[model samples]
Target: MKIIDVICSKGRTGFFFDDQRAIKQGAVSDGAAYIGKTATAGFSAVRQAGEAISVMLLLEDGQLAYGDCAAVQYSGAGGRDPLFLADDFIPVIEQYIKPQLIGTEVANFRALAHQIESIEVDGKRLHTAIRYGVTQAALDAVAKASKRLMCEVIADEYGTEVSDREIPIFTQSGDNRYENSDKMIMKGAQVLPHALINNVKTKLGENGEKLAEYVAWLRDRILKLRLSQDYTPVLHIDVYGTIGAAFGNDNYTAMADYLESLAELAKPFRLRIEGPMDVEDREKQMLALKELTRIIDERGIGVELVADEWCNTLEDIKYFADNKAGHMVQIKTPDLGGVNNIAEAVLYCKQKGIGAYQGGTCNETDRSAQVCVQIAMATQPDQILAKPGMGVDEGYMIVYNEMQRILAIRRAKANQ
Candidate 1:
């Protein structure tokens, strides 16, 4: 199939973008909006609606394959790309990217995606959102051209087998940790409640008592509400570095002691703590996490450490994985620039004996979430995030349904 033309359209993401620095610096929440000046460079407000650009490729056969370009909720804070406003970037994509893609013969995905990753204007690579979406469109176009599922295309190109079973889905509960978790339990999410513990005062507590209490509560609630006793979901919480904040950031021993306490509280359920500390610098963050992981291993702490902050790009993930920075690394899909990198990152983590959690942000679109499911199906990460929103049902539905569709189609093909 050949690309006839490229189309860009403004779109809204499933969630809003929040200034991570402002929130960490005590931005008070006023309803859904934050009541403080923006601390991030490109933000007009501490919290604002997330924007996306849908890059659609018009193929010769009248097929429209597209993907949404988006950024994380905490854009520009953790060494990520700047806030992705569609108004500013759509024109850039049209001017620089559209013409190059026009009339290009699409036979394979990896080369086309890498070409997108290599394009630059004014001496800088295209915004991560643009590269992310355009590559997704490329993958979809190749799949459509070859008459196969997106996951099949990925698996074929990457020398991996498509997952015969559904990847475990991890659902996030924004602030409605209690209520939304109930929803997750009812739905039987494999990984229950990302429990966004971002702040020290409100969520994590000054001494980490608040999060401990919440973990205990979650244990009890899951036991009570689960329809099937076999539905023992892993408790994965993204603390956003609150554990490090409560205790000193470099105080690995203290952090490990606290992690042990939480592990004890989460008895029968396995626990994973993500972003225990974000030193804000990649090298420092890796060392801190490595030391913490070493301590946890030496002490035989039942808790697992997941790396998130400062591990943005494919190279960053490899750097962290090479050092064993954390037991698991979150391949933040959008942060990796191209979807091709997401697959490579996952495979690399597995090669390095590191757990790969295929994750993106709540500030994404349904289309992105769907495409991510295809990637996870092909790559078979340890767990794939239920994304595009924090509300349990919508994100979970988008991810779960896509996985089922892929599995069903693959099953039929095998029978045939």
Candidate 2:
């Protein structure tokens, strides 16, 4: 089967109360949001006005799948929104990509992917982005054509068993200042009066100070819930960094301190840490990350590092890999120039024994998320990150959930 059509959808989606809580208190922003709900909380304040740019691909033999790319301000790049590229870039997908793959065999995903990657934009090239877009579309089409859930496809492809254990997702709440004392009291009284009183603390501001307290609360709550045999839900926290030169020495110190605190609080729950690094401040960010890594190692917790800015190219991955800079490498297909590049990076990481995670794009939709899931499963990265689907527009959660199901099936098949 060949690709029969490619569709690109552009628009914005507003956040929900819970989404806002995650973005503000959880520090959700950029690609980090999709990996899990806790990670998306980092952008609580900024994600409000953001838009989603989605690309969907349809193929012959009746298959439909898609993905999305979202843009947010880069802290180091003078707070400029890197996702701004989507505004001008989506048209390229419509003009160059849609018309070319009308009759290609649906299973020739690689060829369709390659052709999409071949398209160029300005003096720069967008073949990678186009390939990613097309691949996702094909996956969606195939899923639809097969009359199977995405999870089933993933199981067939990966040959692994799906774990019945509920995957953990982080959710954020509380005011920015951590001063929702009254709210906390009301909520806490129902649960634990003594513990609430003991944990009662003053409100901290939006920066790391407030995040520290909020994180502590989340960790404690998770542990308490687990003790009572309420072990299904996973715990998470969101930590946002200031953008541009604003992320200077002070910011790094605050981040370091907050992460250290989180390590201490999260030890009992074995919580995982995933967040977007400020790519604009390369030197300072690296220095801060190095410190954070030490903390994570000491705590024996897994850390997923996402580079919204720094890891935007193949060369960037080389730099990180060569230096052994990060533990788990986060990759965004569009940012890396396409599926081939992302695949190459994953291969490099796998060969190097470096864990890889798939980063999400806000501009993506179900189609884009589907494509990402396909590539993500194919790459077998350690983790898959995508946006939450709670707000006005459905986020990439449906795609992610679908992909998770697919991966589960693949895992089952593999074990068989």
Candidate 3:
């Protein structure tokens, strides 16, 4: 279909409780560099820091065709306090993107994406964000034209079929240092069919005192569900030093023993641990990781080492492969660049005979999620991390349901 018009919407959304600090930190990073020094200085300084969401729409034959929402932090240069609100991005979408996309064919997704990327902000490329908008627009169009649910379109396009049996969606959770993990797990539970809850570090608050008790509770809950039969139910744990630090220096040995105990208890439930190594202490982290891996290996338990902050780019992936850092590589799209970049990383991991998990993101919507799923399927990864809507006000439930539908359709076609 030919693109006729583009419509872009900009608004504010609520932030996830745990993500506030991270979002503020990101805003500060941008604010330090861009606020007062650039043309957007005045605009950026007055803006309030909150959840930013953008919606763009593509039309078949109109001046107002494409639309999508961009939700992220905006900063004022010089480390200013007043951050840019979501609304600050609307004018840019209207002034720069609207005119360019008008009268273009909807099917020329790549060309349109490139055109959007060509638009620059503050002498740096905004291609990543622009491509995100284009993908949203294309998915919106496909959903409308096919007269199918967003999930159905995704399934049809990717050749994956979704089954009614619950699918286990894993996410991490904890407090203080592990707060982000907690929010991610709770959000994942809300969005996916079945949640493989990751009880992260237990060295914080009175909560730490009840770590063992809570794990037992969680274990019992899973057993009651009997999720292992129909769904891939696996509990994951992240063994970063932060957890050890919370409990004090002497707690490191104790924590390792606790993990061994937890693993033994989790054996019957088929629980897997995903240890994301902290790169800060390279030597120590590697040694601890090896010990953990060996323990799991001896017990014939599955363990995946997710390189989060440790592996951000292609070179990082290579390093992990070279050193045999972990059993599984976690692929985060934005950090790796575009879809193509992530695909290459997956290929590299596959060649090394390592499993891959399409990592979660805070900035993905329906469109971005589908693209992630497509990449995951194409790579044939063992597990795909499901982020869904996460903190987005759009609600992850809707986004995930749509994804399941699309995955179902894609699997059906692939088999046929």
Candidate 4:
């Protein structure tokens, strides 16, 4: 019942994070494709320079299972940030993360999973990025050994029944979203068209105008694309905390005023803004988000606030839910440690009467994307983002096609 080996291998990403449409439309710079995909860490200049990390767990009985790790831009500060980077992840998983689990007993999937999540280096918890990979591999190992689907392992472990149903497909977008949006509707997807505005204010000298332009483009896309549904597609803009940095808590009046201005452009379109701002103090930051949500709620604006930063772990998720910081909170899969944690967070959102979006970085591999789809279907989240790439076509196919496969299998088994 003990793990015999752990292997970590290298891989590459599909595209660097870029707003191609914005670039084509002259909203952002030509260099933004590389610069915009990065976080404040000022690490690498290569925009799409990402690594795919796969963790394989070998049991003593020659049974094996594995999972892939996705590299994310804007992973924030701390060892946990950029936890999937090749130099950071490979050595740690091989030297530190592996040894601890290689000989560990796996009699209980839930308990072993907890130990992996809690395993720490230098007195700090294991970086969440590695936790994501190892935990999924561990779960996969155990689930496959039991001849059950990964979600089935989750259901039996958590005392819930597996709900074999189709989960809504949520995919990310670049500036070339018009073409991507057309393809999304063709495949029956609920699109989350986004605009990256973190670098806009600095490069363009005016953030609002650029954001407005992006919003206007989205409005037109919605109109001409003839979105298959009656409800408008949710327009998301990752402010990367630039907006919050520009307008501080001391300037609450200004903050509300600017947010209202943005809302005006997204009028009648369901608007959700991610990472509006970030602060050094997490509790204080959550409070600010709560207050902002309060303002938006009181005004009855169409904009719904979402928390990405400061909302990584289970505690962070519960804190945001309890305080009502956002109408919806992104339960970022990689940030939260593992898949089961997402299950727990989504349930917490449900209990709190808030929305949950199952999210991950585009740096993820296709295997991880498909695995996430299985987990999302088990939980039935409000929405789930396509992974491992910026282009809507491949990411969309990886997820929805898997969903189709799983549904087909279930139907066949049920009829038999």
RMSD of each: 0.7, 8.8, 8.2, 4.1
**For model 2, what is the alpha-carbon lDDT of residue 129?**
42
Off by over 4 Å in 3: 12-50, 62-85, 92-119, 127-131, 138-168, 171-210, 227-232, 238-241, 244-258, 272-302, 310-323, 333-348, 362-380, 385-396, 407-416
Off by over 4 Å in 1: none
lDDT (0-100) at residue 159 of candidate 4? 67
Model 1 C-alpha lDDT per residue in residues 67-171, reported as the tens digit of each score: 989999999988998989999999999999998999998899998998889899999999898999999999999999999999999999999999999899999
Report model 3's TM-score to 2 decimal places: 0.61
Which 10-residue window of candidate 3 scores lowest in summed lDDT? 190-199
In candidate 1, which residue pairs clash? Answer: none
1-416: candidate 3 lDDT, tens digit per residue: 65565555554333221222232233222422322222333442323333434545645533232333333322222121233334555576677766766665654333444465567767864434444445555545555655554434444544544333333344433222133334434444421222222223323222243444545655555445443444334665443333344444234345445556655665554444444333344445545555555554565554344554445555666666556666766665544433445556776887887766666444344545555654454455555555443332243444356556656775677699
Residues 295-347, candidate 4: write the lDDT tens digits. 88888777878887778777888998899998888888877876668778888
Best by TM-score: 1
Off by over 4 Å in 4: 15-42, 46-48, 59-63, 78-83, 103-107, 202-207, 227-231, 245-250, 261-264
* Selected candidate, larger lDDT, 3 vs 4: 4
For each candidate, give its TM-score against the true structure: 0.99, 0.62, 0.61, 0.86
lDDT of 2 by residue, 357-392 (tens): 555444344545555555555556655544333221
Clashes of 2: 74
**lDDT for residue 33 in candidate 3, whole number 0-100:** 35
Among the numbered candidates, top lDDT falls to: 1
Model 1 residue 403 distance off true place after TM-score fit, in angstroms: 0.4
